[model samples]
Target: MKMVIVDKANEGKKLFRYIRTLAPSMKNGEIFMSIRKGKIKINNRIEDQGYILKNGDVVKIFFPDEIIKKYTDNDRNKYRSIDSNIDVIFEDKDIIVVNKPAGILVHPDRREFKKNLVESVKAYLYKKNEFKPGDYFTPSPCHRLDTNTSGLIIFAKTHFALQKISTLFRERNGDKLYLALVFGKISSSILISSSIDASENKENKVAVKEAHIHNFIPEKSKFIEENPTLSATYVRPLKYDSRLSLVEINLWTGKKHQIRASLAAALHPLIGERKYYTSQSLSLSQMLNVSNYYLHCYKLKINGYEEFKAPIPKKFSQILSEMFKIDAAKL
Candidate 1:
């Protein structure tokens, strides 16, 4: 018999749900038959499939050793090992925050089996003896950052922390500040209020539409009509050269590619943004020697928590110094 102990992650979940994680390759019919034939027991007693697991609960499986091995084998081998140079910004018993570099995916996708930030966080925790296979909860990112957008990514070390952080983001109680280098000089602060809808095209894209028709609506009528998926960004110009502007963006609503799409619609596409702004002449890589998009999540603040800041990347600083001829350290 193989024994398992419920941890905080799997606590409060249904027995079947926990079992699926343990034996993902096993069929539902096989699991049902095993339970019906007294092949599973909870705390030394046979429990129904709907049994609610709690912390410290014990589970016993009476399957052949080979079958159990097939079910419990760690799939970590399927992922590539991340670079050893990952940066840990903060860590505690409940959560960890890391500085995710640009060009690394935050999570795994079917298109790529390569290592991602989440897997890297798990591996980091493992080396510290804070995580292990079959633990009740594995450290996981509470939110995401686009592969090219570098900045602070939070990971929950415990399931409780995960739930709490997830709720905080869902309630929009967190503040996220991004810094971007755009193509044109923005003279003043402007609020970009628009409803963002998913593009009808197969490729993942978003369309931003202002609430009312321009000129037809009175200036006072600019109060944004409520939209279920309304996205708002407050852009404040920090510094600008004749050709490029550095702007600090306060993202009030999080949507897929909201910042990139919104800024592009406002005629200030982010430098090196190939998807939203396709102008070949505006390519920063060709003119300014910058290859990647110039957007970074520099700061994040959550309710009841102190603000966190990620230092601007060196390459970003290089572009600022080269193009604007200003000290990036000050910005």
Candidate 2:
């Protein structure tokens, strides 16, 4: 199996409820039976029928590794679509950098999310007989992007690279870039140093001062955030049409939604944001049918390796040219 951590948001829920969150396809009764069979354990120890779960508790799932692997392979083939548009910026013995498109899962989420970039990458590599650890079974993405945020995501080829790249991202040494179409105009790049607070009630709120995050979401492997860190980004106006302006941004910190949150805080929320709504300007939210925002991870620089830059994906640049008659190539 797999391991699940009860996040702070799931604190008050019952153990069975928490189990349901782990695998929605399985019922509570089924989970109960599994627990009885010694398959489910709480905090790395076996759980009885009465075992209670709370926030930050580790839930270990012990089943045959082969079975879990099979489940992943089957689901990848069955659920997520195959996209030929996945752009590879660079690949070496240690790492791979790729341009992820919008409207796809970077990984599977049980919340009715579609299959994503990692699976597509695996399939591509497998088809080319390129699967390996130092050589078969490279690690999954050491980091992630938001479901609606299109950008560059890095994958590690070996355990050593995974560790090094992981540390680099944690130290905020990597360069992250995004291009966005927002509703209004700004004289220059505006960086908002806001603090994000998450309550036990699972609500996330923003504070102007630095706020420390007591992570309740216990990820198997975690990426760390330095609270009140120097989160900087450079934004330059690419072009402006009647209403929206296309801006390119490079972030200094890898906070959860750094670019999105900061931009929205500056009254330039993403052009098609539905969750983080902005009222100061018009967004594509009221416009034609679409499922994603207009931000693209145009480039990523990890550990000063700026050997190449990922060009803006077609959907993002094309939207600018088509909707506003502004070409994004000049950026």
Candidate 3:
């Protein structure tokens, strides 16, 4: 039998949700069945899956230790050598905001074995004695940025903070601003309200339909009806040259590849973007010998929270100066 005590980090989480995090190897059906069969109990009482966990509650799972250990999070052991040099923008008791450089994955996948942002954050917190190994709830990012997109990403230090921040993001109760250098010149501000089809995604790239003048309309087409998502991007041209435009993007919908695909649909693909760009933009990117995309999440503000901004990366700033003759610091 394995037992877990509800802590502040896991407080307010549903029983089923808490179980999935504790025993990750167990399938959903198995968890439901185990709960139904009285194999799981909270405070020595059988509770439904939807029961909200509270601090000091004791959860018991009548499963073998070996089975529970086999599927639990073992990332701490996997990453012995931790990189603690994280660029922290703002940190408080509840949350930490860091600037993620381009070329690092936020979360590790099967193909990624090296240290990622999560590991780095954990290592940093561990060094400060704020986090401990074998803790059921580890600090995690509230949202994700693309691997090549450099900028501010927030991590929740507590479970209560995670729940609150996640709700803010889900309800779009905050503003996220991105800065980019797109290929074509944008004369004025443009609002691109388009629907993205993930079902049609190929090679890790999603398809964005033509922008509509009105608000997003649900996908009625049979081909992409299964996984269509609404997206809106407000592009304000900050500065422009003959070939490229420095633009500030106000993202209304945080869908996958929303900024890249939406700009491509508007004929103003971001410089250095590998996917969702015209052939001419690709040629220009090749000529410039760019290593990563030029999109950066520059600013973020949650409702009733202090606004946070990440300074532009040195390379990103240098590139802008060399290409457009505009100093990024001034903007």
Which candidate has the highest TM-score of all?
3
lDDT of the structure predicted as candidate 3: 0.81
Each model's C-alpha lDDT?
0.76, 0.63, 0.81
lDDT per residue as tens, model 1, 54-114 = 9999999898888776554544332224453578777788888788888888886868586
lDDT of 3 by residue, 150-227 (tens): 999999988878888988987768778999989977768777877787765348888777675423333323312442
Q: What is the lDDT of candidate 2?
A: 0.63
- Specify the highest-lDDT model's number: 3
Q: Once superposed on the true structure, which residue ranges of model 2 sit more than 4 Å away at CA?
A: 1-85, 132-138, 198-231, 282-291, 322-325
Runs in model 3 deviating more than 4 A are 7-57, 61-80, 213-229
Q: Cα RMSD to native, each candidate?
A: 4.9, 9.8, 5.6
Residue 283 of model 1: what lDDT?
Answer: 62
Q: Name the 10 consecutive residues with the lowest summed lDDT in model 3.
A: 215-224
